[model samples]
Target: MDEHYEKETFLLRIQAINKTFLENHQRAINIIAAMVAIIGFHVYAGFAIAHDFHKALPLFVLMLMTYAGLLYFLLVKQWLKKLEPILQLTADVFSRIWNFTLFDISICKVISVIIILAAFLVWIIIDSANSRIRLRSVGGMAMFLFFAFICSANPSKIKWRPVICAVLLQFIVGVIVLRWPAGNEAFRWFSEQVVTFLNYAMIGTAQTYGFASSPPEICGFSAVFIFSSLQIIIYFGAVVGVLYYLGIIEAILSRIAWLMQYTVGTTAAESLNAAACIFLGQTEAAILIEPALKTMTESEIHAVMAAGFACIAGSLFSAYIAFGACPTYLLSATVMSASVSLAMSKLLYPEIQESRQKDIGSFKFATSKFSVIVSIH
Candidate 1:
């Protein structure tokens, strides 16, 4: 009787383990299915309406709204609590694959280096074929390499993985923006829309300051930079405050930070601040990871500052647009700079000490004590 009872207990435990595994497998399948459905619908709708801009605009807006609604539900309403876990799992798998190293075989190292060089040579050939190999392009490449060589903190200890990935990513972005017609048009259209939207602030300024018909020109420009800057700051501050209150900003930032941390091998504080710098001012970006500041290594702090200097804040987009800057170029440069800055920073100030905050989700974002309105103020 005792032997029989023990067998039954062991069998029961096995069954429970199998049941849990099956449940988790099912959950993963369901999440994948939902993502596929959403993407399929988007692709179908895009292909169907892509030919007509006037007809497609409403549908595009609707699609964006749908995505926003789903994001709100998942993040704000806490629907599907396992969503973050699933995302983390996917990110982990990719990160592992990306950072995986071969055995320390000389032949393997030689092959890897050859492959990288060949790919880079092909890229250069393609670029030169499409556009004349200008002195500016050659000079830029030389300067970048020179900077990396001269500023490296620990020349022998520098990790090339993140730096190489970053440069490749920047190159890919440039190719998409400059070489692809569709991408170029998309960016141009988006830039035009941004300029048009920011122009509304000028209308308000005209109404408030009585500069409607004949506005005071600054440096031969019709738009007053000060008024537009003030309006945009207040507008964005309130919007960001509300989004932060709803946890949307945090959720978005966390995912981006995680991606950068894993892919670029930066510490959590560095990655988080880098992501924040894309949208926020340098000071504001630093404040996002304020708690981690004290514990951050010199390399991490340098990365944060470098990213801040590299990226243009979203609030400043209006000022540049008012100044007749090509918004598409500005946006592209900002995006590319973020990656290059991290690569350069790592080279300049190689992390010597072990990082305290390694996990992307380890750091707590700074919270506001006041209500959203007061926080905005």
Candidate 2:
């Protein structure tokens, strides 16, 4: 009887531990929910102030709302483990097409960016119907037709329920943040001070380790110090520690993944690309999604690589913009790469997919020893 009682106690303890383990992610969920409330209020208030402007360009505002949430969610990459099953289902539908002709990621990167940017540029220059519009109507129609053609080439798995819930949550959060003056200020502070700082650190690391440098115009200040390995090491080390402490790095990327899953089509695991952008840059993003590489249809891989080519991480954004590379060019390039990746992967590897939550967040940052070797030549 004593033994039996002891076993019962042990079982109860195990059950209690399991409950706590599951509850760990609840805090993240609540924070996201609060963010949703904040943003939702903001979006509504924007509409209340000027309904016509909001209605005329709801897509732009919608894009902004998505960006706001993505910026916040990116801070919580670690907690994404709990969100995989759901994310997999949400992202599956957005996978783009696979083009057989594009042989390698390196070249496909250029092709895909050109295609996406060209399309966007054409739309801007041309008018749709020419009602007090200065642009050409034929060009606008051609660009629209081109996107339709591309999307038609690749099919996707549609799971609208999750998409609906996610979008509504995002919109609601926007409104709430907007309605509460205090919340708006807080969110803005987080973006300006927290997010920008984190992104800058990533930029510095990529240049140091990835071997890319900002153009002279962009690197006026950073260019001087970036030349020193010692300085970079210290700067990067500080970035890692501070990011880890504030949890901002994970939060921002996670939100980006969430937004991509909703807007683009892919699995939650696909956010490996975004996560990679933060630290590893583009090819590094591939490593995080390594498991899916074999399973990913060909088109998806191309998009992944192309996104790396098109968009430098947040760190590189300021540099490119400063250099007159065109910020929209970079942003749209990444977006198009992701879009095309899904389509291409589908054509290459056509199989019903399972989720891969295990590979990505288990990232281990192993520090290496650096020994100075100086020889006179």
Against the unseen true structure, what C-alpha lDDT does each candidate score?
A: 0.78, 0.51
**Please, what are the lDDT tens digits per residue for candidate 2 over residues 1-377?**
99999999999999999889769988887899999998997787677657666333434555686777677578566468679888887666433232334555445435665685576556545534366353555466346435544564333553322323332333334433555677565555433443344355556666665544433455354544354333434454445445544555555556567665655445555554644464445754565455566655444555566456644554444445445664434443444344334433343333244544423344232222223222223
- Which portions of model 2 miss their true places by more than 4 Å? 1-248, 272-280, 290-299, 325-377
Off by over 4 Å in 1: 1-59, 68-114, 130-132, 135-139, 212-225, 372-377
What TM-score quantifies how close candidate 2 is to the native fold? 0.37
Candidate 1, clashing residue pairs?
none
Q: State the lDDT of candidate 1 residue by residue for 48-152, as single tens digits.
A: 687786757756876887789788887875855658888789989976665566674455445676798698777777667756655467579768867886878
TM-scores of the models, in the given order?
0.71, 0.37
C-alpha lDDT of residue 214 in model 1: 41
